[model samples]
Target chain A: MLRRAASILAISALVLLVAGMGISAQADVIVIGEIAALTGPTAQQGLQERNGAVLAVEEINAAGGVLGKQIKLITYDFKGQPAEGVSVYRKLVQQDKAVVIVGTNFSNVNLAMAPVAEQLKVPVLSNAMEPAVTTPEPGKVNKYHFLAQPSSIEQGAIVARYALDELKFKTAACLVNKGNSFATSQAEAFRDYFNANGGKVLDYIEVPAGAVDFKAQLTKIKASNPDCIYIPQYAQEAGLQVKQARELGITAVVLGANTLGVPPFVEAAGSNAIVAGTYFINNVHFGDPRLADFMARYEKRYGEPVITTNVFFGYDNVYIIKAAIEKAGVAEPEAIRTALENTKDVKILQGAGTITLDPNTHRPVDMPAWIFKWEADGTTVPMTLMYP
Target chain B: MLFQQIVNGISVGSMYALLAVGFSLVYNILGIANFSHGAMIALGAFFSYWIARYLAVPVPVAILASIAFTGLSSALVELVTLRILRKRGQGSLYFFIASLTVFNLVTAVLVYISRGNIVSYPRAFLSGTFTIGNLYIPWIDAGMLLISIVCLAVLSYVMFKTRFGLAVRAASFSIKAAQLMGMDIDAIIQGVFFVSGTLAGVTGALLGVKYAVYPYIGNFVYMALFACVVGGLGNLTGAVLGGLLIGLLETLVSAYISSAISPALTFAFLVVILLLRPQGLAGRATEEKI
Candidate 1:
């Protein structure tokens, strides 16, 4: 009886302590929640995104934060799962009481959380590149969801146009991963654009997800003798495809989405010589003079060079949120949603210096994608920025 | 294109063969499928990667060292899981579950260590392709085929021509009878695990060289399992044949039919073959061991 009473007393004390801490946490701060794939296959990208968000929050607080209050960023790990993204969104909105949420460059994760964001009535500034993340349908928009980058369709169309008009590739072949929506969406856009604009699509091969080998498909593609092969796969898969294509003596110019420009793609391809001359769409040109300060600060803070373009997404998402809250003139979810919808000419560190979300689609308007070529020495040479 | 696709199939087949032979060795002796072979495959890749990266050793030396390490790890797994279960007189089902748990645990541990980042070997090791007329064969693929043949040859010689081979075969025939005849069943099981582990280790290292190294490379175990199943489960030659056949079928289906549905087509072919011959291509009609 005495032991039971003592246990009850301990449990009550713990509850009181938790409640007190919760109340204290709500004081003098605007809570902003972030969901990222912190501990899964894409953890590196997620962590980079988190780091970028943290850096922006620190900078904002250092400069006497928005609306006379410091922003308290609460980050949750979605672990690269879509279902976890929904739960995390609910927790952030209902439990944490965050006025705005920033996060996740993964299109699927952002897509999963879009409906929940609408239900919860909190504005989510996402870095995901899927068009459907914001505008789920042609005419309808998810009011609370906003994208910080150009959609995958835009990226694909831009690459296709650049290949046809700039490189003068008359015939093209597309290698797509059927299981990944990101790859499929990009590949479809590229194919449609390329076909509609004089260039003939020789072979359109779709491989399953987790397929490491591409020799047989490349051999078939080689038979067609296309001028260029557009492979819109993730980094590792794209790396393997390019390497295998070169091995099969398919010397046609290789084109890919942004994933091919990352370190993993180079690493997976095994050598610079193998990947040399491959063209890929990029989010940011790493050698851009304007990005020098941000890169230096990131390297200084993280003790490593900025690895991927996700840093820009994370950094820009926080700044976008801050701009929204400031524009709203009140630190409420509904007001922030309105301000984000009307977001125009906000300065952030990606694509042509400023972001203006097309309130209709909730995606940035006239956003340009940078095209980069892999040099023989493994360094990426930024060629030109193509606007959609 | 047909010839090139065939070459591609054979190249991929050789990889599946390497993994299948290892998996078959364990199933031959113990009717249970030891899923921990998957963990050993992953460990083999990571071990070689760690050695080459941190010790800064040459690639060949690192591979050899990792092979030995993985062999010991396989034996350790046997000691901790299978041997304990055997002593307890438990069913193979328990070992199956335990082996799967080990596979997941090791992969999770690797995910933590590598931070889920896919990494390649620090230095170039067989990192280029060579062409033959219109045929483009990567040095890594050729190397893997040669290595697979040599490993199979050596394994065959050991299994058919050695005293240890006699003991192992005796145990497979009947573990109780073998023990009654004074054969060390425990030692034989440990030996089989070690050999299988070495095969897994070599496969992992070569796979890392072929593709980039990542934690989930153990997913290759599924192909290995498929190879073993399609081959006579206990038949070594059947395993190789099944591996090559599956590789050829996958390549051909993708080349001629549809890359999108190639996996489904390949599995459907497997189902047809199994329905036609339940004993597998090389397996003889016999009573179920388990």
Candidate 2:
């Protein structure tokens, strides 16, 4: 008799929960979804991205939201896995009824979600660096996917240009993780550009992903005596490389991608002195005048200073969606897609200035990569900026 | 350069040796793999890191504290999981599965608690490098090599010269027979786990000092398992040999050959050696006494 009563109570609770969600669904608000790596190896970046987006939503609703309707964000954790990314994308589209999806910063996850986004006919804006996330084949574009940041090809070109033209590096060595598409593409692009621009590549070393020890590779690179070394890897591996390279007495100028411009990398290096002389190309500058208000608001909300440029990626993506929603003048997914394709001169954060989406490839057009150096005091100072 | 690479190999190999020896201890007597040893390693690292950071203790002292704590934790794991299974007359497969489950469970809990952040020690311990001729050796690598050697020496003395070691050997031969000879079987097993866990704690703490500390640092168990298998299962000396061989092979292969296929080449080499030896590098063929 008690068991039967308990079952009835449980059923009633579930019914009430569903009914509550249904009432909220009918409210005068537009639901946008985010799939991020909230708990995994890359959780640091994911959490920052979420915080940035949430801050934007709070500020937007405070000033009255887009299209005369308040914005509601529904976020799900992908755990930095490609399979989980796809499942969450499906849930965000089918069950949550999100008009548009802001996807993960992991290139592999974005690659997996690209096809799903097209089939579901919901546009996905991502900061994943892989160029293949937006363009799958030659002269073929994944129409439903949009990249908010510069792609790997563009980032590689910037690095190569900086090394060859600005830094005046004559000979370089490449240390790339072949197992990761992001690292592989960036390394290949850098190599091609550097060679074409009259710079010599001493040796291109391929390190398998997740192999922590790089002393052997660094020793080889040191023996070759390159003017600079390119380390196109995520922060953790890049940090390890930097630490080990210093230990092995390789004093070549170390250059890395956007992922290396975060606090986690510095922390992982154990001492800031290890990374003091290193250079990395990033998308956003925390010192930019445009980010003063955003930075203050972010620190006030999160009780911590901004750690990575991922914050800007998340913040800018929401504003991009808001612009599309206002231009479309409707709270429908299809209309938002059309408006996003025609997006132009929309400013939020990062890039050279205002963001303009390419009609042909659905990616940000001509975004500049900002180069920064890590000072001995553990602070990043802007060196210069490069555009491609 | 070659001498430096060799030194690097030996340093890395010693770490693998420490991990393999710790893993092999529980397996030798229990006749089952304790996959939870990996979790114990991660726990040791995080525990020492927390102690050193929050309590402002010396790193070496913090490491000693973590060793004791993890030793107790390992015995507790056995008290809850394997002991219950053993009481139920369960097979080795069940114990293996339980151990694997415990590893995953511990990893998940750590992820939740830490939010999956990769953190390093507040102060660098055993960092920087010094040059001898043309060879550069990081201080941490030398420290790890020294610590591993000292621990292995002490472990050897205990295992070969002590009364408890005699009991452990007897238990490995036959648990029923050991009990018949007036040994408390449960106590003996618990003691072995404590010793093994202590070793794991030391290894993990040193590794955290060498690299960085993260929840996934336990994934190094794959290297430990490989070393244990290639050396000879249940053989402490073989585990050390296997570790050194694998580490040296990996470092040399990556240095001279293609780094891209080094892992594949290492495994292929292991497979060839196994095919030739059949019973592993150190194992002797013998009939089942049971």
Best by lDDT: 1
Query: Can you tell me the CAPRI class of model 2?
Result: medium
Give stretches of model 2 more than 4 Å off: A1-27, B286-290
In terms of TM-score, the best-performing candidate is 1
lDDT, candidate 2, A1-388, per-residue tens: 9999999999999998998889577578889999888887778788888998998888889989986789999989998789899999999888888889997788889899999888999889998888899899878988889888888888988999999998999999999998888898888899999999999999899997789888878889999999999998999889989999999899999999888888778878777899998888998888999778878989999999998777887898999999999999998888998899899999878967689989788888888879989998998899887888
- DockQ values per model: 0.80, 0.76
Task: List candidate 1 segments past 4 Å from native.
Answer: A1-17, B288-290
Range of the 10 consecutive residues with the lowest summed lDDT in candidate 1 chain A? A37-46
Report how large a share of the reference interface contacts model 2 reproduces.
0.73
lDDT of each: 0.90, 0.87
TM accuracy, model 1? 0.97
Give the per-prediction TM-score of chain B: 0.98, 0.97
Worst 10 residues of 2 chain B by lDDT: B281-290
Per-residue lDDT of model 1, residues B1-290, tens digit only: 88899999999998998999999999898988888999999999999999999999999899999999999999999999999998999999999999999999999999999888788899888867787888888889999999999999999888989988888888788888898998888999999999999999999999999888999999899899898889878888888988999999999999999999999999999999999988788998755453
Candidate 1 on A72-165: residue-level lDDT in tens? 9999999778899999999998878898898877778888999888888999998777788888889999999998888889999999999999
